[model samples]
Target: MTTLFELFSRQHVYMQEESAPGFAPACLMRVNPDDWGRIAEAARTENCRWVAAWGEDRGDELSVNACFEKEGAYAIARTGVPRAKPVLPSHSPYYAAADRPERHIRDMFGIAFTGHPDTRRWTRHQAWKEGEHPLRREFPADGHPPVPTAPDEHYPFLHAQGGGVYEIPVGPVHAGIIEPGHFRFQAVGETILNLEERLGYTHKGIEKIAEGRDAMALARLAGRVSGDSTVAHAWAACQAMEKAAGMEIPERAEFLRAIMAERERIANHLGDIGAICNDVSFTFAFYQFGRLREVWQRVNHEAYGHRFMMDCIIPGGVTSDMGDQVTVAMEKQITFLRTELEGLYNIIDDLPSLEDRLDTTGYLNPDTARAFGALGYVGRASGMAFDVRKDSPYAPYNRFSMEVPVYQQGDVATRVKVRAEEILASCFLMEKLIDELPAGQIRRDWRIPPSGAEGLGFTEGFRGEIMTYVRFGDNGRIARFFPRDPSWLTWPTLEKCIRDNIVPDFPVCNKSINGSYSGHDL
Candidate 1:
């Protein structure tokens, strides 16, 4: 396989070695603002997936970053644009995943993407005045208190014109307890012509809060990025911090970390399975799966003092250890849950009515999935075979066997089947992890590196690959923090999959993709 350095070097980027240890184990380069799009297109043509793109406000220039991955290798192409004229060529024309983040960067840093297709504001939507980038160094975290926020009813949505087309607008608020997001659908009768999503309703200014935070404080904040994804997000943040400081955690802690991630994965898959079933009016299946999920969460609570395994994963190491009895009990619980889950899945799979509802509903083709760089179950169901655990192993994953389930139907049924298969795979992984549970200390002290330390953390959470970037300031405080959640990419595909599908079936389709509103909004 060709290396990342070879790919970028071929594109005439000025290659540079990053001094911060363990940030991203790949070649780094600084590119000219004009060649940013060219360099990005080269990597995309070479089959590299788009990871993330963001902008940092330097005093004199804006640092624009486009992160890409291929063959388990990552490359970061950054360029410094003069602050007075903050303009960079857009990477979105080649990578659809770059579209939202580029708009986000434009909204947050006032850096214009010269050739970006969509120049509309994304993250800021009237919260801040025109041309005021909240992420800039000059913008105070606690800005002057403003007047009551005005209602945003006049968003210019792209309306479809047809013989019988009509518009159906859904939530910035919902009847359910789930988070807020607005959806605009153009449909004729029940057939949808187009679906547009208006997210960022749950935007919490997470990156803004990370400014000047100590390591521990940042960890706490990262853990809450999405409550269900606490373990994965916190782990990614800690990995970045530890790597920057050149700290190595213990083997036992690594094993426990794996256990926490797997548990988090299993819990979410369980809940998602039930939620998906419930959306189809399969009430019995929902109840049964709900019971199984409740039992599974209770086990996590008994084992780690929290149902979702939140805050159990700390920076440098895990906060708790599994005693011998607890280990044995967890092993048994895994077997029981797996068997029960299989039985529950068999019922859903065998039921023709359930199958009819999900089989071809919300089909996302392989071509679309490829173009969007979809991740997690959404990508897997559509035949995209990139899994962070197997593709780019870290900790216990590199030391064990991994099986990533892939399906080609790109339908709701396929998505459901993939989740079912992943639940089984996670069970096997957990058993192996417990069987080889290493014996050693669980905590390590990480020293603060000098100012300007930077690091990157990449991991496969339940939803999919999560990448976090961290750079430190003086006194070990966080300077720049960005969490590129899988939801960021997956949310876009939700619109594509629903195309040409009936409006009423949108709920099941929505549940199948199940993008995290909070994670993406942040």
Candidate 2:
């Protein structure tokens, strides 16, 4: 496999002599503004995945950063432009995944993307005026006491014009307690011709509010990015902070973090499996999985302090240690869960009615999956064989073996099967973590890093790869923080997968993907 440096060097792109401070198995390059698109084109030629892109507002200029990964190696390319007329060529032309993120950067930082296909506002909507960019330093965190804005009914959505095509507009608000996002569909009869999503209704200005916070405060904030992925988010943020501070946590702490992450993965997979079943009217599997999830979460509460295991991962390490009694309880619970899941899976796999509904619904071809760089089970189900734990191991994961379940069917049934297999894989890993529990301090003392320290962190969340970038400002406060959730990549693929499927099958297709609204909105 080619290294990141070799790939860039072969393309004749200039690399900085001194790399950025805190990335491992990854490097940072400060490229000229003119070389930005060239760098993206080079990565695309190498079949690298475009991970994320965001902008930082300096006093006089704006800096844009984009990350790419190839063969377990990561490279961050950054460039700056004048704040007065912040314009940079778009990378979206090379990578489809960069489309919405670049639009988001334009909306948040007032940095224009030259040659971007769709220049309409993404995260902005009607939240702020056209000229106002909330992420700039001059903008207040409270947004000038926040006035109520009128409804955004005039935003243009793509229209399909044909003999029989008509529109179906779904929620920015819905009947359920889920977050707000609008889905616009153009359909002929029951078959969908096209689908477009309008998200960011739950935009919380997370990046703006993250400024100036200390490490601990930031950890707490990261945990709330998506309530369901609390453990994964917190672990990624803390890993970034710890790297910037140049601190090495205890071995025991690493194991504890992995254990919590695996448990979080299992709980979410169980819940998602149940939700998918419910969408297909498979009430038996739905209730069974729901009961299993409740029991799993209760076990989390008994061992950790929270049902979601929030606030348990701090900067230096984790907050709590697992005692012998807690380990015993967890091990016993794992055994019970595994046996029960086997029975449930056997019944669901044999049910012909459930099979008929899910067999080929919501098909996402492998080519589309690769083009969008989808992640987690969504990508795995469609035969994208990239998993952070096995491909880019870290800490406790590096110490043990991992199995990533992948399938090529790319349908609702395949997605459900991937999740089921992953639950079993997580169970195996959690058992190893418990069996090899180390004895030491759970956390170390956190130290303040010098100003201008930068760090990048990556964790394979239950959904997929979670990448976080952090740069420390004066007095060890956060200068810039960006956490790229896996949902950012998966949400767009949902639109592609739903095409040509019936409108009524949308629910199961959606549940099978299960993109997190808050995770993507942030």
Candidate 3:
């Protein structure tokens, strides 16, 4: 296997490792815009995972940054195009995960990614005019009054050519209170021939609002990036800011962050397991799991004052600390949760209806999962073994034993099993963390970084790898902030997995995957 460093150096890519102010070292490659395609392809050929890709308008020119991970380290490939031209080749041909993001860049920054297949507008469907690029610094944060969005029905979708072929168009607005997204399915009779999605209905102009905000403001906004993944996003944002500021948080804070993260993970998994079962009309597990989740959230509210732990993580450290009473109470809850979860699993494991609904439904092969860059439970179930906690160790995560439950089945059942196992693992880990809760200040005083300082935050959210990039400007303001949620990568893979399955099974498959619309929309 060729190391990413050796591969890039072999091609004389003009790359050098730049140490982040207080975090991991990142290899920064300076390449011509024309050569970006070739270098990006080479990186992918060497088995590198695409972490994120974004574009920034820099006065006279536009700069594009592509981040990749290999062997527990990160490398950034960068290039610039003339502002007037703003054109560069796309990396989507080599890395599928780059497709949507590149299109988003084209929509927002007017940076044309040449050679991109299916270059139709994504993320910006009538949100702006043809030539208007929202993230170009000049666009007002609060744009002109909202205009009625044109009907998105004209968007081209692949047609299934056959006598029995028909198209089923699901919601950009659903009956349930879930976030809006359009899903198009081409099917022959009951069997699905294809699945395609058009997301971004909930785009909140997050990246636009992030500009010029201070560290605390940025962290607060990051928590709202995706409601369910709030803790993960805030922590990642703060990590990047702290690194840029050269700030160090206390050991106790790191442990507390981990505990909060694990709790978040467990809560989501429990809800998902129930929801997936309920999609098959197995309301028993749904009620039981919902009960458990309610109790869990009550505790979160009592202990952290937030049901989802929002705003708990801040730059330089956490916002608060836990007392011995909370620790003892949390331990008791964990013990009870473990006993209840085991009993529930035993019954669920014996149910034939669940087995039928889950066993081989919505199968996403390992090869497909790998190509699509699936993450967290979705990737682990399909045998794509990559977990940020284990592979890219950070803080207290590196200090603990991380057991990533992997299953090769690649079906709804396998995904559910992985979630269940993870919940159990989180329970045990939480117990360990509380038992060994060290004594130290939860936060540390810190100074903001000078202009041009940059850092990146990588964390394993419940959904999977989340990357938050931060750069400070003059007067402690943010120059650029990009939070790449794992949902961006996982959502595309949903289309591939649903093929050949019947239309009725779609809900169960979707619930099992449960990619975040808001997370991906941003």
Candidate 4:
């Protein structure tokens, strides 16, 4: 396979000699706005995955950056357009995953992707005036006071017009305590023909609020990007910051961080498996898994001081450390979890009715999974074998062996099975990390780098890959920060997977995917 750098060099794309500062192995290059589409096309031809795209508001022009990955190497391509008329060709033609992100950029920074098939307003659904862009430097971090705006009743949703096709609109406000997102489904009788999602309702302007925050403050904010994935997001952001500052944390901190991440992965998978079962009315599995999760999190609080492990990871290193007793307890919990999980799995496998409900429902083909660049269990269940820990090992991961579970069925059963397998794999990793606990300092004094330095960081969150980009300005403050949660990619795939399934089965299909609404909204 051709390397990322060579692939772009073959296209005669002008790349900067000095690579961007990041823990992740990547290079930065400048591309002309006119050549953006060509660059994207080249990447697609080489089978490179589109990572993320975001816009920065420079003083005179709007700068757009697109990231791609191939063979464990990353390429970040940048281009600028005049701020007055921020128009450029779209990459959505080459990578279907780029469609919504480009629309998000257009919504936040007023950049126009001229050839985009859908010019609909994505993130900005009457949140601001017609001409106001929140991410621009001129826009205030604290916006003007709230004003009464009309309901989004006029927004256009695609109509599936036929003899018996009718539309069913689900909630922007749900009955349970969950973030709001509107889902429109066109169905003929009980089977869904198409599903479209409108999902900016939970937007909190996280990107705008991140400007000028000190290193510590920014790390806290990154932890909250999506509450459930706190450890992964904070680590990604801190990795970016530490790399930009040319700082390496102590070896002991690295081990502790990995332990937290694996525990987080296990806890979330347990909750998700239980929730998916509950959606299908398998209450026994739901209650059992929920009980296990509650105990797991309670142990987390006993060991790490926070049930969710929030604010435990800071810029230089982790804020919390484990003692000898805590390590022993954690090891014991891992053993207990494994034994219980195996017994539960055997019981679940024996149930023919449960198997009947899950066998072929909500199938997502590998082709669609690849086209959308899906991640985590969503992609793994569909036969995409990309895992950051195994593919691009970092720190503690580099020191240990990793195993990734993959399935080709791409159905609800396959997805559930993948999660169960991952939980076991994480238990194995946690055992290794705890047994090899190092004796050393957990953190080092932070050193500030020069202004205008940029870095990128990524980690495999429970849902999938989490990528963060950070640029430091004068006074060591964050000039620009963007966190690409895995949900952004997985959410679109959910819409595709739900088609042809009966409306009653939609809950199970959706619970199987479990894309984060807050993470995507940001």
Candidate 5:
């Protein structure tokens, strides 16, 4: 298998180069700015997908990078904007996934994506003054006066002028203890005509805090980007840091990281499957899955330090170490889990009502899934065979044998089944890692390399592939760090999936395809 770096190196040598201000490789290939349009066309033609688009502030300017992926590799296309006027073309017309990130960059850096469908504010609020951009280096966080709020303005959505069309607006503050995000549903009675999501009410400016921070500190912040994804994000950030520092983790440490990651996956999947069932009014499934998830998290806290395993991953290696005794206990737990899972599957499969609620609800057809660039169960359910652990094969994943489960239904049922199968698969994989149990030190000192080198890291988080790119400053601080959560892709798919579904089924559909609000808000 070839490394992403190797692929980029080959492409760099063959492609034409052009310079942009404040960017590392001033002379990057100058595809026609319209080339973005062409690239989108090619991805559709060749059956590929867009992942993310984010900007890194370079003091004097901003450099935006958009990534697209195929089966074996991915390409990052860069577009630079001068610090004076951070403006660029919009790809939302072609790929719907570009909508949020472009809005986010606009919110944080004041960069504008011209021709974007909706050019409204995302993360910025009345906290900052009219001329202020909180994330910019020039904007100070100290002693700022509270700004006045503008009179509420109407959000103009696309017109659905049919006789039966009506609008339904749901929460910025929810009934449950979830994050704030508004969902605007345009529907004809029960059937949805269109869905527009408004998120970023909880934006924490994680990227702003990341600037100038040391690698070790950044790992802590990265882990907290989304509490549920603590292990994955931290692992990605650490992988990038280790690469930039020219350090390799010990073989034993790598295996431990993988173990932590697989465990994280199991915990989340169990909770989600149960929650989805609850949304469909399947109390038995919900209770069983919730009880199982509680056990899973409790085990994590017992073995590691936190229930969510927050701070369990560090720059050089994992913070928690599993001894033989813990390994034995885990083996026994796995045995019990496997048997319980089989029984649960039999129960779920026997219920025709459960299948009816899930089988075709919130369906994202294959073409739509590809165009929207969905990942994880959303993509896998639509017949996309992309799994970072299987395709990219990072850390101990490369050391083990595995299979990526996929289905072609692209509905709520398919998503649930994919998650369930993956949980079982991860249990088996973790057992293998624990059984072979490498004997060695689990932690090592990471040396910070002299400045100017950049590093890229990718991990298959429980949700999907989470990516981080970092370029170190002259003082070994983070000059530029961009982390893309899988939610960036999955969120757009949610909007697409809700189309044509009954208004009442929105709860089950939304739960089945749960995208992180906090992670995306960052």
Candidate 6:
């Protein structure tokens, strides 16, 4: 559990351009260029996981930053390349989760990861030309030249076949009101041998859309990244911006933000547990949980001004203020939710069929969970207790009591139990926050962060750890903003978890480990 600075200071590794910023206690370690592989190897051996990667545009160059963290230590590795030739070493060989984001950066900024396994276009559609990158400073947003005629072609997909090993292609479009992402399954009979995911079809060009936006506008965009995680995402984005710009927020604002975040957690987990029950055809559990979730979100809208609390968090502080009336109402709702959840848990735990169906199904070993850098409930369910709020405390979370639940079962049933436990924990936290709600202003003036400086914000969202990496330019505009949604790691875990499970049971397993396609695509 040694810090990155200590590891370098102890000469276990070499570091360059190290800076200790006065604001937040973070070690700005500049990774030496030639030793990337060695560093990657050491990071893996030391259990350090990849945090995120982002590229900031200079006049003629792109500055790429790859960040890694373990315990409480964070290291940011910087590399730059000419705008004309944006190429760098790929970390896919070392970290499996690096593949999608690497490909995404390539698609957005035309940055190339030389050894990336799958180099096909990720987010670029027919809107842009071959060499054009949307995130580049000079890239035009409107009135581009007409695209030349290239014959319409089908997307190339990996094929698998060996007698019983056949392919099953699922949706880019599904039957339900869900986001689009294609799933290619290679299975032997009902047992999945391999699964390849094709995501990003719903890419809203959020980064592209956020250009030239003010801090408030950016907060709205951040909340919309994944609708279910509005509070956490907006809070995280503002946390980074507020820290970077040296803004001070009121204590009341911080507490309100935490309450909103915890409520979001409770609602999402309730929905997930219900959905998992529905997936397993347990009608009673599904209906009961769904009713509770519906009531919960309604209370959120009434108390927070938005159903999802979108734009509730801004740069300097929170946008929404909670009065005593709303606080009292929330406590009442929480009381009802606690009673309902206890009853539901009692019934669910007593159902032998439900227990048998979920137990040992869709297992993800601890090693695989850590190797993939899984986060949140899924990670916690598999013995990875890396909650950003607790592991890397921020704002109101630091002032409050927190307990992160962990389970070592690493199966569908274990994931369910962990999520249920988290739901109860969130209720306790929300109640405490309401009771001890501070009194003060909710918003403060915000200034743009100075140029050429980088900072990362991490939050424990309803799903897991949501990491945002940002770098500002001289013009007081964002040079690069890379958000690493927990969905990216968790989605792959689903593929691994479905291995020995039957095709019919896939629905239950999938629902239990739901990962957002839109969030990951971004």
Find the 10 residues in a row with the least total lDDT in model 4.
Answer: 15-24
lDDT of 1 by residue, 392-455 (tens): 9998899987889998999999998998899889988988898899899998876886798888
User: What is the TM-score of candidate 4?
Assistant: 0.98
Expressed as tens digits, the lDDT of each residue in 454-496 for candidate 4 is 7788899999999999988889988999999999898999889
Candidate 2, residue 80: lDDT: 92
Local distance difference test, each candidate:
0.87, 0.91, 0.88, 0.90, 0.78, 0.78
lDDT of 4: 0.90
Write the candidate numbers in order of decreasing lDDT. Answer: 2, 4, 3, 1, 5, 6
lDDT tens digits, residue span 183-241, model 3: 99999989999999989889999998899999989999999999999999999999899
Q: Which stretches of candidate 1 lie over 4 Å from their true place?
A: 12-20
- Candidate 5: tens digits of C-alpha lDDT, residues 265-311: 99999999999988989999999998998887888888897888888
Output the number of the lDDT-best candidate.
2
Superposition error at 209 for model 1 (Å): 0.7
Q: Which stretches of candidate 5 lie over 4 Å from their true place?
A: 1-48, 125-131, 141-153
User: For every model shown, what is its TM-score relative to the native structure?
Assistant: 0.98, 0.99, 0.98, 0.98, 0.91, 0.93
Indicate the TM-score of model 5: 0.91
lDDT of 3 at 330: 90
